[model samples]
Target: MEMIYRPLLPATQYCPCNWQSDSTSLHSLPQSKHASSFLRTLIAPYAPLWVNSTPATTDNSSDDLECPQANINYRSAFEQQKREAAKKMDATTLMMSLYVPKGRWQWTYQVPFENRPEEDPVTSNRIWSLSVRTARIYNESITYICKLYPREVQWEGFFSEVKLHKTQLRPLHGASTPALIGIQSNITGIQLAYDIPHHSFWIQASPDMPDILKRRCLDAYHQLHAQGVLHGNVDLANILIGGDGRVQIINFHKSRSTKNDPKVHLGLATPQDFNMEMREVHYKLNYLGAREKERAVWENRRNSRQTPSRRTTRRRDKDPYAIPMEPPTDPVRWLIPDNWKPKRFIVPGQSREQFEYHLRQFLLDLEKSKIHSPSEGDKSQGPNRRPPGDRSPPPTRCDLGKRKRGEVDSEDDDDDDDDDDDDDNSSSKRVRFLAQTNHDDGSKGKVRSPPPPGVKRQVPRISREYQNFGESPKTFAIPFISS
Candidate 1:
């Protein structure tokens, strides 16, 4: 996932808005270094530090550069990213600086979580714990999610295990990223951070672990065959869940089938149809058959025998700035009304990368098993019993300690109460995602945003389509959240 950015390019260099490239092709980059440099110079007043700082290393393989252990490298990248993000005062700041230069669509505005009435669970024997939401993932080019935890007893390890898995549909919104998020400790609470606008996403752990992100995981699998990339997990929660039932996907399609680890089991698997690219690299090393001439011949025969790219599969002659299409005729259309929408960015506050991991397991099922699915492999019946949380990394801080019985006090006394609703904890459904209509006028219209965090906590259940045959328990949202 870190490799998504060319090693030394600044954030603007690989900005999505600069040019819309075929999502499946690595060769179709959005901008060149020279163009990016010019864009940076123009926007420097709004952004002082958004320039290329990747050390000029000849290695070319970011994977080999002390990735997991290189805490210093990760920290350096993060600080640099932060200095670049401070210019965002309002929508125009991002539009002029980040989105336009990059050439992709830019989506902004707080999602339902902004109104969540609750605070992170406060407790000092807290069997349950929640990670700090970074307090600042709202803006940033880099993101980090922890993936390890240790419990005093293995049973704590078990339930804590049940707790941290992003697969379970706990609609609790906090910090998360597109590629990965997790922790490895007995403590059940862990926090993650990410860059929503950038296609390149990251988590602090597992080069292979990013596959577990909700959106990327499922999206990667959904188009595996067309992209010449193999799809792995394809469950509902594995991808980003939006306000209007739209789903966005991620997770590297290049490395699923051959990469499963025998020791971790995680109950993860993929459908059989997924295939890797002939020129793909894995774990920073190339894994295709050796001998360039023989490899070329092999790919030719392979491409000849496989299915042709589908009509639904869209490719571009040159990089386009956005996903374009004629306006859809539907009067109820939220944004542009047409099949011409560019792929939607994963909605903020929802974890799509996590869903992809679960979905990969499902995709393999589609390939290996003979089940018929409503979509890809939706099961008509209840899901097969599997381990809870589908092999998520253990929680590094899995407990919220103990909370007082009186902790559920009303929020009428809180310092800030703007648009805050006081809901009877005993009654009211949790709003899972945001839903609203907006005109180009930028007026705040009616919105069905989620309840505040203080309201009765809603436990998210994986959509039935992904419970088993789909197997991804990640959150799914309303189809259109962007305006």
Candidate 2:
């Protein structure tokens, strides 16, 4: 593909020099020799586009001039050299050059032009580019992600990121972030070494993701933070996970190093202030899990309500004249009887099993009382003494007669009512026992009414004075004795 090179730096800052046949090739330049010549062979096929600072001879005649005047003259000469070099970068060379700075400097290796530079679709950073092809360096094919700063952009971000990649991220290479391959002037190359197809963490994020995968992604960030590098943007889109289960962080254009406190660049915050990146990641994961779980519960309830009964479906299919009925919108309200009320006696803050266990124990106690027979000593102790299970004793004829005579006197009626209250309490206990028994039997219990007039009994009554005054009256005992 045809490559276009826009001048990234002004002529004063960077001077582009054409490759000369008489001059030394970039590969033959005196620099640190690699253990292997693979890098030299890689760049051998591509023509050299630019060269670093060309050495100049100082004229001894200018040494006698004033210090300020001589410095001005030297600066003017350097600028003149840059302008001459800029004129050499003709239209033909501009169309064929890459976006790298105007220098033939060698880094870890050399990259030959495979395709033109394209804007990186994945990066959140404003300044980013992707080479349209991969480079097989040292027998390993790598996806080359490039950081590009054109002429209009500031060079601080590009230089700082390169410093971070070459220094802070060196130890974490191939583990957390991508390894820095090399840089050419305005463009930097890093190795995205994953073998399998990958996607951003945002695309595959789910509450249902395996615990191992979540932990792995989180651990990758911890590893990065340990290197004293803070990823200012801890977004899901910046994290990459491969199909082969590898997790790696990317887009370090916004990252900062706590260890290096150089002059602040590009209005970026300090590393200490941005330490919350790890915390943000953790909270986001928890939010996703909770949100998904709640959604699942709601969906389950809706599906259960929407599913029609098989019997109803069959009936509708068989009846030709049957009218189609829509499902109830509020299923709970439709399915429950109108008279059904919430249970007032249900103990709050208890699980279903706990409530059921306590209720069962109460019923068991009632059953034990019902099965107990009266002891011989208790039965023979006194005529007034009844069985152990009985609470109120049957009143004698004499007591009933005295109570009835007492009711004749209006002042004495209160005393009679008080005495009857003890018997009423005993009757209530008997009713509760029957209710418990009925509960165990799965039937409704009935409250027994007072017997007919032929039976001897003391029945509760309301006083006439209290009733006439329109106030709640006390219970009066009625005498009914039969021999």
Angstrom error at residue 74, model 2: 30
Q: Considering summed lDDT, which 10 consecutive residues are worst modelled in model 1?
A: 99-108
Please give, for residues 156-215, the per-residue lDDT of candidate 1 as tens digits: 322222222233211222212132232222123222222232323211111112122222
Off-target runs (Cα >4 Å) in candidate 1 are 1-132, 136-177, 181-233, 241-247, 250-256, 266-483
State which candidate has the highest lDDT.
Answer: 2
Query: Candidate 2 — which residues are off by over 4 angstroms?
Result: 1-111, 116-120, 124-126, 129-132, 135-142, 185-208, 264-275, 287-483
Instruction: Give the alpha carbon lDDT tens digit for every residue of 286-389 in model 2.
Output: 42243333344446666774433346432212322111222212222112232321111121123333333333333344345334522333322222234345
Looking at candidate 2, the ten consecutive residues that score lowest on lDDT are 193-202
Assess every candidate by TM-score.
Answer: 0.20, 0.33
C-alpha lDDT (0 to 100) for residue 25 of candidate 2: 29
Model 2's number of clashes is 2
